[model samples]
Target chain A: MQNNWEKLNQELFTSSKRVIILSHRSPDGDSVGSSFGLYHFLKKFNHHVQVITPDPVPPFIHWIPEFETAINYEKQKDESFDAIRAADIIFCLDFNTPSRMGNMEFAFDRRSKDAYVINIDHHQQPDNFAHFQISDTSASSTAQLIFDFIIKTKGKTALDAQIAQCLYAGILTDTGSFRFSSTSPHTHRVVADLLETGIDVNAIYQKIYDNYSQDRIKLLGFALKDKLKLYPEYHTAIIDLSEKELNSFQFQKGDTEGIVNFPLSISWVKMSVLLTQKDGIVKMSFRSKGNFSVNELARNHFNGGGHENASGGMSTLSMQETLKQLESILPDYKQKLDESKI
Target chain B: MQNNWEKLNQELFTSSKRVIILSHRSPDGDSVGSSFGLYHFLKKFNHHVQVITPDPVPPFIHWIPEFETAINYEKQKDESFDAIRAADIIFCLDFNTPSRMGNMEFAFDRRSKDAYVINIDHHQQPDNFAHFQISDTSASSTAQLIFDFIIKTKGKTALDAQIAQCLYAGILTDTGSFRFSSTSPHTHRVVADLLETGIDVNAIYQKIYDNYSQDRIKLLGFALKDKLKLYPEYHTAIIDLSEKELNSFQFQKGDTEGIVNFPLSISWVKMSVLLTQKDGIVKMSFRSKGNFSVNELARNHFNGGGHENASGGMSTLSMQETLKQLESILPDYKQKLDESKI
Candidate 1:
């Protein structure tokens, strides 16, 4: 994986450059963490760095250092595009293809002919978009790649608490607090190095996980109590919240996040779904355990596709209709769901 | 910490010895992990090692290698005491003091006079029970200390996948899968080294965490939905399950193990409690965040004491009266609970 990455230090980084870091749409922890982590590291080299995201990051990660500085393209298009157009070196992080950049794709294609692109991601597959790339699917998160990148180039001394905090957040969330299957020995070692930089581990965890409001948690309680539905025969569970239910909790954006994962905790549950009715549409989330392939399920029936275990979709129907539609489609996948393992 | 521990290798372990490992009563992941971990490691040196516990391990950990070899004092008292009396060296793990052994204390005091008691623990205020001891309060778990002890004595090659699995389970549970504040950089590094021994991280995690029965999760769901009561004014939450409620779900031992901790995930909840009624007794569990000291609350109000953040108690009164008594005492702790930080 190291290959010719030494050129980053020997060539590009030796000179001050206009650098813009681009991450995927609806930036998650890895997207925000890797982008900002690299942005923070590049600044020490006298480069003008801008972290441009396809959309605003979740409220849970707002405590991240300089998170406010990230340009959300959906919210701040002009600023994001300007940074993209003027880039000397574009670091596309966390995501593999420019299409993953959402609205930021055109800016990269039409305006950044003079820029050198570097792709550092842990996802599968790669296109010929980057002048330099490191695609390691075995890596737990892109933050780990950034850690290796810095250690490979400048060694461990280059990392400070700020750099370590962002990277750790990326790894921590992406690896589900180190519970996910992707977490490897190297992942823990990377976190060990990050902890050595004196990052407040508990503070970071609380800021990301426990930062929800009382109403948000209450909504969760009501949702689990009243909304969560089980299809035990199909090894499936669903939580469908109507607009009226959301309003009862004074719902805010991102409040219902992670609510979908609760059902997956059940040992026999192969698939879990969360549907929320809002703005005349029912947004859908699908998560599964083992090889049930929620992606194929979402893509085939719900007009969406994601990874095998997690996916997303939307419904232009009422919450009841969506729930009915979801229930109607489960029997076809019942055999596969039953065969899936946790 | 490594003061004169060379004697462990140069003198004590120079030849095979009859070694017996003991852990605390109602053995948790740490107790079982540390004891079995040392048991596995010591056996590699041709030592006749037996792991004797005060009770059977939780069902989740039964997958651990040779877990069937474990001698449970509650069920097999003769076997446990025979092993305890025949010991040339005693490795006291997880718990700090002899009193932690519960019914086995008298046996240790009366029968093991010639045994070289080696106390390896991570708890606070260990008594002067061992001739050779390592009581490190800062360590993530006794398993981590054992990792250090083994590495310090016999080097890394002394470890195998079985030993690593046991130790990792210890650290995984005691540190709440590395989420607790006690986890340090060294903890991760120890896990990293354990993983390097070719341990199946996912398999271990699934066996320990995902091994729950469907009924257990359903019980949890019902508890959250029908039982969880929030008292935001005092930053408290309680879930009390009556005998009828438990009967509805066919409650099993360890089913409610982590149910008390769910409310602590709420941002403002400084303390959470779980009460279970069975056989005319109301068993109480108290868990708190920051420094509110559930230990003192359990001790002074409920006739039980444990760590400051987590404790246990019992109520001979009816579940209703016990809950009423619990709620009435909250006003006195309102300020302290509010002041406690997460």
Candidate 2:
């Protein structure tokens, strides 16, 4: 089944042409990892390759090799625009739709019209923007898909420590260090193959999980202690942090990234929500255990959607109003929440 | 070099015999993982196996397969004692000396005079009590050695998902989720092989890392917020949790396990000290980065020794006195600490 995509990707990579790899805005481990992993692989063929993200990579993930070289469209718009325009091939990674490209969508849409745009993602409902698409929703991470792409196009020998480290970091973080249900036996096998490349897994783990600042830890403490609210009857937990609270902590871009999943740690709690006021709107992240569909809930009520168990949404209303809206919707999910409980 | 031990292990395992696995007191992931890993491997051969820990396995690690079957010597003394007495072979895991077995050492010493004792561990300075020893301090975890032992004794085909999960958990936790220097490429290869057994890596990671209680996270919040103190000149950070503070959170045995390492995340910090008031004494944990030797400092000043980067100590003084004593000793280490800076 993948042979068709392999053939296309192989044909695309045959010559050393200018290439630009673009990951979605607010690039995560998967986005950065897949871009860099493919970048290193493509660089081997003497291609003029440049990796660009819609925004900056988080400090925790800065330890990835060649991370500093990736252009941030948010900071250096002109250079990023030029790279997108000059590229012969553009690898759009980790995201599906053009809307996910954020402010860079305009440039990407204009420049990539003539270039051979290839979409390699694990997200559901991929848009038909790419000329070549290799989307598998079951993949643990897009990094895993990139690994497969590398193995199929260039063979397994092409995976060096740098490439392996990037892919491993992608898979490790995206799968929550391999706890998510999306992780399969094949994921482990790929990890094993990557490990054989002599990449330091421990070093990478520290760079990702243990590189937090004192302020971040303190902010987490404050969030868990003061902001968390629980409604045990609905098996729901929410932690809401206002912009003022974030400013007090001097919050960076990725500081509150994993805070949404913390509430799901409670044995009784099946649904966890994190509502953080960012810019003019409140951004909401939804996480749940078992079969309760946070995707449907987010899409129907909050104008957003993602994976079945995990999803994102936004609210234009005030924090109080959003809280009221969330409270009102709990009754509709009572039976689903109760059934999903351990 | 492992070939000799493998031969001896194979000879010992030729016949179906009663096997009792003994781990050190206050059983950690490595201790429990190795014990259970070997238990499952031997069970495949129809051997009568019972694992006994001096105390209860911590709740976070309770999800390991067949964990409930492992007897706790502190709670089920009679059964544990009888198992030791009836054993034909004793597998001592993750401990250097018999004293580490706590009260169970007396029973082990009495019963093991006739039974074959095999020491499989990664700790430094292992005592020469075992008839056969496969002690390698370079190994990331004792569970890694157990995986080698299984492959050598029964071949790689003996590895199943259950055994692989146990071994993987040990390596994951012991290596601080593959962030420690002890995690060599070989350690990763072993992990890769384990993953190939169809063990769910994500599920195992969740069972080990994500199973924290609300009280534990809250305790962590308090420790970081109110308890943390820094000695900038010495590049030292300390977090002291008092008995009252612990009681407020209803702290369990392993609640404060990794709190010491949190301070080490600071880029400029060279050493981290965790002082917790327990029983009548103030228990201390020391951690350092680079060439600094926390083990030497703990041994000479705090009456404890362990690894080079990580070690444990204890002080019989009050919290105030202990803090003062620690402060007084910082001057002596100032030169070494400054020299060790990255």
DockQ, per-model, please? 0.53, 0.41
Pairs that collide in candidate 2 are A178-B202, A179-B202, A202-B178, A202-B179
Write down the TM-score of every candidate: 0.93, 0.91
> lDDT tens digits, residues B1-342, model 1?
344666666545789998888889898988888888888888888888888888777888887789988888888888778888888998889888898999988678766678888899989888877878898999999999999989988899999999999999999999987878898999999999999998877778777887556677667767776688889999999999999888887888988889898777778888999999999899999998778899999999999989998999999999999999999999999989878866
Candidate 1 colliding pairs: none
Best by TM-score: 1
Model 1 regions lying over 4 Å from their true place: A1-7, A10-12, A222-233, A317-331, B1-7, B10-12
The per-residue C-alpha lDDT of model 1 at residue B201 equals 78
Q: Please write out the lDDT profile of model 1 over residues A53-156, one tens digit for every residue.
A: 88778888888899888778888878777788888888899887889988779777866687878899999886767878989999999999999999988889
Q: Give the per-residue lDDT digits (tens) of candidate 2, residues A239-263.
A: 9899999999999887898888877
lDDT of each: 0.86, 0.85
